[model samples]
Target: MFKAGRTAAPRTRPTSMKIAMIIAGTVIFLLLGLPLIVQIITAFRGPFLPFGVSSAQWGVTNFITLWELREDFWGVLGATGAFVGGSTVLSLLMAFGLAWITVRTDAPVRRLISVLVIVPYIIPPIVKAQAYLLMLSPESGVLNQLLRLLPFTGDVPIDPYSFGSLIFIQSLTNVTFPFLMMVPILTNMDGSLEESARVSGASWPKTLRRVTLPMLWPGLLGVTVLTFILGLGSLEVPLLFGQESGKNIFSLKLWTLISSSSGQLPQYGLAAAWGLVFLVITTIAFAVYLRATRNAERRASVSGKGFRPSTMRMGGWKIPSMILVTIFILLTAILPLLALLWGAITPYPVAFSFDAMLNRTSFAAFGTVLADPDFWVALGRTVVIAGGSATLAVVVATVFAYGIARSRKTPWVKAADLFASSSVAIPATIAGFAMFLTFMVLNPYIPLAGTLIALIIAYSYRVSIAYRSSYSATLQIRPELEEAALVSGASQLTGFRRVVGPLLMPTVMAVWIQMFILGTNEFTLPAFLAVPETRPLSMYIYAMINPRSAQLYAPDQGAAMALIFTLMVFAIGYGLQWLLARRAIGRARKAVAAPDLTPLSAAPGGGGEDPSATVTIAVAKRRARARVR
Candidate 1:
């Protein structure tokens, strides 16, 4: 029907869609990238507002100020290096051990251990620090109180403020990320290579070192880089435990520069200069990881054929491995949680005594915390912040994710993806500082400083996270579904809404809950922007125990507040998980109850059998397994 020498008109998106995409791209860039740009420019300038505010000359005055604090800077750098390095090493060791036992070795109660391992990850960083503070503080610390019971040990045996304690407590939760990273790698790794080495007379350790580890180099490197980066940006642990031990960290220095409470104006340039160090370090580390990943991929272990992942027989080591895992779980998660409970129930800090716990335990602290009007106000504000930010992040991320997945070659859409992900390298601390500077610059025009809108906007830095998750989920779905909807006379937006949205619901909820938890627990952004009226629960808890807040410092009441907060978080997490599981189970049952009809000629056996029926049955079984997972 086409005429020769006539060209078909090119396909083009509707003008409305094009304009919407442009607006979205602009907003994403402003929301995510503008703050960093503002901070970078501020670093070059003196202590003054940006955007034509009258201030000092632009030079390396910030660097000069840094030089003036070189003595303090170097010491903080050394402490930071030690803390990050030590925590990285310890976290990797623990994570790898747990992953190996759960994935490769025949360990008892592997399922239970796997679930227990992630428990600490769910606990807020500040809560974990507070738990240890209760357990290990030299004076009135539960552990020290118990230690003094020994006749031979007259003085306190440990100091919670030491670097050793700092690394240990940080490693407790930091282990979860590396553990998550390694689990999939180990689960899918081919066992044939290790088997061949073992059959060739290599010892288990030799085979592991030469064959298994080399194949896993890329994953190990990725985990190391991420864990190290997390360790570097840590704020709560160092702030809580490092102060008394003189272990001033880089993050704390940045906090001090911007949020100094000694009746002085904030040194914006100095804080930005300090924050820039994190940006630089993260960039270099990420570059190294990319190069290493490419080289390591040359020796890929997984393939479509001959891929066998077998669990190792623990043999005589089974009991020891089980006992060791049990002890690790107890020490890392259970003990710390119990410490919180004890602190909450007791009128004051005391060693664990069953007699006293039964006879003298009081819910008075819980009652006191619950009775405060400020507590209720903080709780309400936290819920709104978490819910609002999570919803906004998911929406923005979902739109960008859909565009990136659908329009692979579109330049503007590709740029939109880039702008959205540009914030991933910026840690919460630096991002918070940057937002602080940005709001100050725009305060005259926007008047959003110290507002809930400011906190919500700041927390949406996790849009990058949500985008990554949604993008992966979106890619798994075939575009043909959308095409089919469009062929049936639906608009593009309608097709996406009716076809793709249903498929993405599970991923959407997961990302939302994750961002929600993060928003609830994070205090760095709130630390800079929150005033009294807008302060959320995490900031409230931090202030409660802060030594500077002498009048507000009440460890017992803070313990009660933190315990309640932790319970609420856990309830939300597990309750939603349970609901999702129930929904999946119901769908699976319906899938099984449904019947199918197909031509016998298409069946494999071809003896009056229906291939469609077999497929339906197999799909139902698969859904069952997915629910279990």
Candidate 2:
């Protein structure tokens, strides 16, 4: 007993875990960050060394001059910041309301409503913007035409290029993030927490403010920080909707540096400088968010168990909720879809009227875009890239999650879990840019860089955290089952196949489908990654939308393509969700139906309540608020 495990040094265990999380964190940081490092290192490696021989001279001279000369850089930075702040606030507000509607009330078709709410983001922003342009562009857009028809419009100039309009558009694309972010939080919360508050003379508003919000703080912090970084870093929304408003943001500025035909030496150095600045700003923000969260946790832990989630019976509000959710679903899911459909049918000669909606010309553009070879190539690239990446990510996350969640004594195993989850807070664009630079500098020998493989790697790395979270939760399932199989002399792989893998298969499928849909919509990464030969469909759509491109940006074609993509991804995601739901519900049904295990009577004076009754079902499924506490 030279070293009983405890005496062997607990320090090594946590240190190993820390290293794993740190490596994972570092890899994520490299996704967007390492590019600037590579860029700087490359500049220094050049004949005319940047900074100096010691690498210290790579400093302010380049940065100050560019910062002085490039007004667009500053404008883009400001616009990104403003849009991120504005959009994050607005989207979270909407999400809270919608979350409340679906989670708290006995809203009819609640799951359907929730599904439809998320459909907006599933459609590419490029396609979504195309539809909005058709509906709201000041000249021929549907909204503009309708506005002009009104009696009071003679003096009005309804520009879609307004600051307010840009903010509104950005808000729409981002609303889904908060919705997605809040789902797990809301669903896991125990209702008894809120119920306890309600029974103690806490008015509804008061209970929500005093009881619910504190619990939601972590999600709010995490989501807000994520939104801010994306907002600050994103160039897509501003490029499309904010362009006319003179809203040049960092992402767009980066695009200009890389894409514009500036006769010679197109400002790579300056772009690199901006990249570094952005990375610094983002890093600082991340630090602050982490600090804020830690502080909040310290405060909240003191009163942690005060409020539990409880359901509020909607005496008369149930039908009204159904009606409201139906309208919301219609507005978010149906109306834009209707626009796409109507746009698709009008053929041959495009007309900008209600009658044109039926004109035959709209159909031609759909045919035109689809028949284009670029469309097929881009679409094919998307599938291969997303499919390959998501699969790898799921596998890595499964291994990592299993090791960490099941670990009895190992430190390194826990580290992997911590690292995998940390990447969630990092913005995708940063990760994309970071990977771009990383490849440029090192292991350029590998065929993966800047090809479809490069895209896969980036997507896989960014998405790894997501799968890790989902799988880690799932990995908590009893390992005893698998151990028993091993004890029965089953082979390792056999035990995995007959025991562990079967149980995890449904969850792994869910993560895979989800990652695929998300991977398809990663518009920015592809923009940077696009070569003439291997351009992703997302970039293809953006090119189509460009005023300069020959590809059709006509509403009918664009919306049709958008809807096609949306429906495709929705089918994949919902398919997995349905499978998971069936498995979970069947297990739940069996658990509830167990004859010997009598649950506490939910009736007055504690009589046994029917397990299958609607009220009990509602209570049973009501999201717990334990996390909130």
Candidate 3:
């Protein structure tokens, strides 16, 4: 007989289930994957007119234009390389440092550092860019103003439009991502090896370099690939500062190609070519990420035996470490926020001044923004669009992830998984361009361009994120739960609804919360899809600060609105997160207090001992080993 708790592998699934899987796979592909395919095809075809490619012919014409534009393209490519590479490396370094300090050292305010580092991740890049513009704008900026007062300082001390500034701000924004990813790895590391290294005369630095870092290569490699690829698609930093510094990047170039000067037609073919190059880069990066993660099990440092994480004692360096972490917190969280608050309360044409803040500070800007009917309308649209997209994305992602977990070997399932996850590599800029083309093509039949439906579809691209989370959660759960329900005469759908659904609800809610926040703050997709009538809050704020929008260029107003927007998102996001954490704790406590009713030995195929008995035997073995040692 088969081992206890193991079900017989089904050779065939029901035809209805097969049909359902196929339909689900098709829907996911059509939504997430088709855009990339369209861009690839459009690259080879002729120019995409306002209507369609009806008069276009297939050739290397776009590639020819790409070649003709090689000078501008190469300049942009170099700038992009510098921006993406610098930001990725810097962010990874900062993240790793913060993770190490918080997890492995006796750093001050470790809990506070952990919370503050993640705050920047939720702040919109546009908001950050605006704040920095006020804080570091060389002439009128707050920091520069402060610097000019120094006795030894030059006339201009800091340049916000420089590559260094761009990299620093961008890195600050995303450093929390790798920090979060690295924390568990650092926390779970076995300390015995480190202690042995110390016994063998290796110093802390050498031990970290030779022992700890080698073990962390796989994780670092994965973080590097993802962060670099993400940097390539970044729009706001490069858009705001790149051209100002004569360092244009690919995303900005792509946007210019689409929304060219009034007299010029959009260079759709060249934009497609540029996007294809980006795709190629991300595809290679993702492949490397996969290859590195494939052997992750080998790098696993934790064990069933007593596992202790290494903690470094900072006798003399603790204060310096605290200072460094404090500076990081100031840069990543406090400074930008303070700048925004200052800008919001100050008069129009905002300037940083304590004098103005104390004397001229008025709540009028807040009132002005709050009282605007357009602001209310935009806020409503943002809530609906972000909430609706997140809900739809989570539902589709759950179905796709469930299908992937249950039928990993199915060809359609494999394809769907690839397509759904691949969107992570597709930058929002390229995705927006593709969506624009798609909606324009279908405009005659559907008339969706410039509509709320278009925004919803565009924003729902967060499916990849939800899919990854749900897929991992699904795999952790045992198939026995569903099978037992099936044995009790429950249909497959009923088993999922009655058994697996509750189990997965927590993960589903967390993913929904994350996607909702992301969709709400997302700028690139809505910029491409939203019209005046359908503008979300992000778009509205963008219009306000945009210098080109002469009629609406009110940086103070934008600052006030963005401040309120940030507070609302933070409250909703963190409040929901707190609730989810509480729910999770409640469920875990219930699980512990409940009876061990799982069918470990009484499973249909069971004949021998229970699984708990094996665990008991292992515990005895471990105890005996401990006694012998």
Candidate 4:
């Protein structure tokens, strides 16, 4: 097959292109990462207000402030660690077992189970808190109400506000995440890699321990880091579900600083300092995770193999295990909606019965909202602010992702990737608080002190990682199609519009919708950045949650609000999925003009199809081809 040909040396690109890329990357990093850096710096703002953005104030004042209430502060931090650890361990076990069952087994009803598992994750956190409250409220809880009706054991309420309940709810709500993470890796893994270990007489547990565990350790590390950071930075579930009864996470302690009645004027500096401390813990975790996974590489275990994945092969564990998992799902996802609908229809101090089902469907739950101008103002503000911010973030992310994927030949691409992904390590709370501090100072320049601009920047930076990941995949499609149009006399912009833009529309739309849902469901950032004039729904819900307000049934009001929020999220998700399907059909119809090259196998040794044979020639050829490569 050798032919006489002269190969020319590769052409070199101009140095200016690389220089331009480097500058772009540096600028992007500075923009996203500067706030965290500033938080660390501003902690030294020296026992004073206005924590000036100067090196002079960059001392240890804030860190010391944390220890001033040494016992309480440290105790809360301990509680934070406990919450993170318990939740992490539980989520890991749940995810691992569920992933194994769904991926490896012929678990009956697997499809429905998989979908239901993710449903709770989509439920708003406040909604979850409300449902738990209804069933576990100290005195008039549904559980207590039921106990009273029983002939025996009627003396007490279940009281699920302890550290135990906090762990239970946080862990249960997060199990869906690890399950989602494992699916892709499990699917892409080669069956053969596991087979080799099995053939060498490894028992199932041994195989998992020595072979699969080692290989999946990187993923485990990544997931664990994410879970730990999430819990450490958490505020909602613990704040609402935990009692002063032996559990107080750092986030709660920070809340005490803000909302504790005795404080003179809001001490932004101390709260910011606490936020900075939380950021420090997460930063250390991120650094450790980066180090641990630094050398981890993808290992493919199977190619063409006769080995079918082993099914769950449940001997006696089926029914009991099903009962356990079902109970959890029922409580977390199913009960929440039922409870929400019930509370929305019922008045405050609700007593329960099957007869309550016969009560009139009240528009009153929504009626309260109708009379309140703030409700529509908040809803309209949510649409205009959150919706617009999410869209802009996606656009910026798309451009940023394109710069990295297609234009990485420029020096700035590395910087863009680092900044975009680095946002993942910075929780929304820290970013929001950082911006809160930064805005207070920068307000002089842009008058951003109380506007949506501050919140928008915080939200965009926080959600940029999702946008970058989604857009990066779309950008990796071949550029030759666009280049051909340009060469055919189309302008550069026209070529992108005609070629690249159409292909990216699916991901662009998806990122927009997903970010919108994430933004709306988000509570913590809005708590910090959203104010009375431009408040979001989460903050509105927060006001209702406080017992001091005229509205004592805060849980019911929030549950009603949350139910509406959840429907809005699903509407967006379903709408995007439908749009994506339609786009695919349209593209397929238009592809009739393109030639089909089915006769030629593309990849080397991609061998012909096997019409028959338990042991096919195609497998041999494919294996041989892979080995050669």
Candidate 5:
């Protein structure tokens, strides 16, 4: 009789496979890290040619020049601080309100409200900026026009291009982010804390202040830091709205140093210097973020028992609260969208009036955009680069995650993870600049700058950072399933393909779609790396709205292109969501039909002596059952 309890010899991966994994990890680390190395070297080099071409003579002149040119540096810093600080605070407040209403209260139409809140985020920031500009431009804003129609209203109520307006626009664009972050924390928090407070004779308000707020402090702080970092690095909003109002933030200042010729050579060294400054700021912020999250995780108080938090009854306030949320959605998403639609049709920005609507409304802008051959080229390039980069990033990240998960004992895998994660602290503009320097310095042999390939590389690098974190989590959770496959006479590749692959498909697809959305809207990377022939739609839109581009500046045409792009993004997002939903349903059905074959217990002196033996026995029994069938 066969001894079913006998332990088998330990399995090891092939030597060639181990070598290949090491090689891949090294390549990933180098690719992700090379840009920073280039930036550091470029920052210290002396300016010799136009656009700060490196002289190879190392010195502190760049830093000194940056200091001497600091006439308005303090002012720019003040503006940046105000923009980042105000946007963070306001965004947090708005997010808190939305999260509380939706998660804590018996708010009307919670599902609709949640969807509306996320809609603005789905709309690209470039498009949102254009919409806001149309609605808030001082002389011809549609909102201003509506106000003028009111009694005794003469001038525009508010200028869209002011510092305060910058904060407002940034807050509106970012509110959904913190709201998304907070909702899950609010949903998952142990309800017992709040229940105990209420039971101790505390009023709802007191309970919230003492119990709920304290529990949420970590998430709140983490989101605050994240939002502040995002706000600080924001380029499009400041470039579009702040520039006209003479508000110079650090990002815009850095852009000007790199892009503006101003009848003089571009200050590449100074730009690099500025990039270093921003890098330091981002690094410090990231450190703080890490600490806050660690502390929050330590303080987490989830209980094993499943209990739902009680929702507050809105009572007489229900209808009014719903109205307020509806209004918020209208202002945040609908109004901007309507503004874009109006601008797309009109010949120029105009107030809402019957005459303007009837005569000025036409598809001339779209016709112009579509008629141009360059538009088609740009559109094709955008789709290919965005889709390709997202796909490539996901594939590479998945491989890296798998390698790291399986080879946690290997030093190279740890190094790869560290290098990839560090890229998160690098700001987008700085990353773009770093790519620019890397390509420029090596272009003689490699010839990558000013090409679509370079843009793809930049976008892939940027996205892989997020994918690494996502894939790492999913990989960690399912190692035992893969081990079970291995125990049942499956090779590593076969096991991953048959077992882990199926489980990871949904997560992989979600990451791919999100990365695609982000890639399509990417501005800074393409802005620095793209040449005229290789320009993507994002660059096209930027040119149309750019005040300095006299020949290319066409607000109506830009709005038309933005609207088209926005619709495309939404279509892709919705399509993917539907597909994933159906896939999930199919999986659920299959799971229901399948018999449960999980191991009941471990037998003595068996391979079941190991922790993973249960999974192995379950898988083996399932295989035996399948053969019998």
Candidate 6:
């Protein structure tokens, strides 16, 4: 009877567990999967639907019309190709140089340069566009004025509104993403291969050419593909810089088709067609990216044994290299910030002469911004929405990751993982459009559109992939600890809360901060879903700079708002860093004070336990002590 009872209990538990996993997986699929399904249906519904209409007759007319609009379509595709290619190449070269210098060379002020390299990414891309516009504007640019003062210089050659200028500015902003991606790969790479080549009579340069670059090929390819995809989908940079120059890309074209300044009805079906085309392109690129990443991971097999790379001494080139890097940082990071400050204070764009500085600077624009009650209300609304969205996203992602991690043997979990991972490849414009249609057209009874809740849902869809990735990595922690807790008479939920949660806290905190920053800076979804009362800071700044708006072309006021927004983001980021640092230090101190339970087998006249056994016993003892306390 007892043997039969034990067998039955085990079978029953597995069945229950499988049922729970199935339910959770189904919910996640519906939440994320339904939007894409709706988008496809909407695309087949053709370009015109009556107002407040939820249903449309299915046809292939939208695709046919899109094919007929080949002139505009081809032009946008060509421009997108050039922009994505130029930005990707330039960013990769610059990021490689910076990463090599910081990670492998003995350069002066390397730490400062390392910190400054990420500044461009930290500032929102919209603000980056505004800063360049201030500095490179042909009529009132400070840099152009300084150039005109030079001998034999008639007019400044820089054209801020040109396609070349668009690529240059966008490259500066996009470089940091690849830089961050490459630094760790370069830093942690095994140096034994290069050292062996050098020892075999190869010169340093030859060794690097033969050994280092080859080993880094996979990583480089992965970063290149990823950055190119990002550049392909970028909207704000091209929207701000290329819109006036008649250099529209696919994203901008999609935006124009769906949003009419002249009060013409929006061509919803045409926009859907563009999105479908873009989706196909992104899907192919993303597949390539995935393959490259898998290859990189497979190739990155440094031995577990300790081995540190040797740094190259720059000799006489150190100072010069450092100076060059410093100048680049100043141009990319500091100059943009200074431009924002200058724009905020001046009555209008002015040359950076001493007279202009002394006569034109004031706090009037900032004061005007501060005095607007709508500005305050918008700021408050943004804080709440961004904060709430980030928190909710972290929770949902953690739950989803937990389910996937614990149920890895189940086919349902595998399907869930694939769906969540593939979500990242969807462009923000497409995701926003899908969400917009999902709520506003397909399920209007839900009442999510034009509210903060809708914005939260959109942001979560965009950011949950990041959290899932983070949590999945952390979930690699062995399950033995949780099993130990279970054996000690705790329920499964209690074991997770007590044993796993604390261990995962650091990763959870990091994900929360990342999601918070992404939500704060997000613009695309808010543009699609946020009503006027629920607009975020990104939309607020966009309105100030929008040419069609009645804000009197106040780039100065927009600059002021940008400066404030940047400071707020910086503060939140640094504050969290400080708190995490302090928490880590506190843990170190507590660990130091804890009793050392080194096995007695290591002492004289003690029972001699095997080394492996001794280590296991010590760990068990420590855990027991922790439980007691």
CA error at residue 1 for candidate 2, angstroms:
32
TM-score against native, each model? 0.89, 0.75, 0.90, 0.82, 0.87, 0.89
| Candidate 4 C-alpha error for residue 349, in Å | 2.5
Highest TM-score, which number? 3
Clash totals for all candidate models: 0, 36, 0, 10, 0, 0
TM-score, structure 2 vs. true: 0.75
| Of candidates 4 and 3, the better by TM-score | 3
Residues forming the 10-long window of minimal summed lDDT in candidate 2:
620-629
What is the alpha-carbon RMSD of candidate 4 to the true structure? 8.3
lDDT of 6 by residue, 1-629 (tens): 35454444435454433444465455455556777777777788855542256556788888898788788778777888887788889989889989989999888778878889988877877788788888777877766676687888668658888888888877888889999999988988887777788789999789878888888888887788778877766778777878766356776777777776648888877778778888888888778766666756656647778677768788988887878787778768988888888889987777787898887889899988888787788778777777787776666566556657876567765666767677667777788777777776744567777888778777777444554665576567667665676667666556555666676777777777777877888777776677777898888888887777785357788899899888888888779878987998897798656566444436343276567665544564446335533
* Model 1 accuracy (lDDT, Cα): 0.79
- lDDT of candidate 5? 0.76
lDDT per residue as tens, model 4, 385-501: 667767766665655565567664555556556557777677666776777667766766768876876666667665465546655765666565545565565654455445556
Relative to the true structure, candidate 3 reaches a TM of: 0.90
All candidates' lDDT scores?
A: 0.79, 0.63, 0.79, 0.67, 0.76, 0.75
Candidate 5 per-residue C-alpha lDDT over 335-372 given as tens digits, one digit per residue, 9 for 90 to 100: 88888888889887777778888887998999898787
| Deviation of model 4 at 75, angstroms | 1.7
Better of 1 and 5 by lDDT: 1
RMSD of each: 5.4, 8.8, 7.6, 8.3, 6.3, 4.3
lDDT of 3 by residue, 1-629 (tens): 86789787979757554566567667677777777777887888867743465688888888887788778778877888888888899999999989988898887788988988888877877887777777786666767777898988898887777778888878877787788889987888888888999999999889889988888888888788878877776777776776666346778888878885446888887888888888888888888788778888887889988888867888999988888888888777787888887778777644566676678888788999999899999989988998999998888787768778997478866766777787777778888888887787778898999998888888887689988998999998777666666666666666665667777899899999988898878888877778889999988998888888889888789999989888888898999999999999998798555444342224332357676655434333332333223
In the range 1-629, model 2's lDDT, one tens digit per residue, is 57555544446345343345345445444543455566665333432223322533444565666668777666766776776778778778877767877776666677877878977877766667666655565554555565677897863346667877777667766777788778777765666767778889899889788878877777678777887776665556667766556345667666666555545445545666666677677777777777778765433422356545445677787877667667556545565565565555554224365565444343566677778777788889988988988886776566545545555656765555544565554555555655665665454355566688788877786655555655565556655555556556564445544556656776787778778887887777777666767777777766655766654544455556666766766776677688778988897798577553444344333256554453443333221111111
Q: Which stretches of candidate 5 lie over 4 Å from their true place?
A: 1-17, 48-54, 149-154, 201-206, 244-247, 315-320, 409-416, 464-477, 484-494, 590-617, 620-629
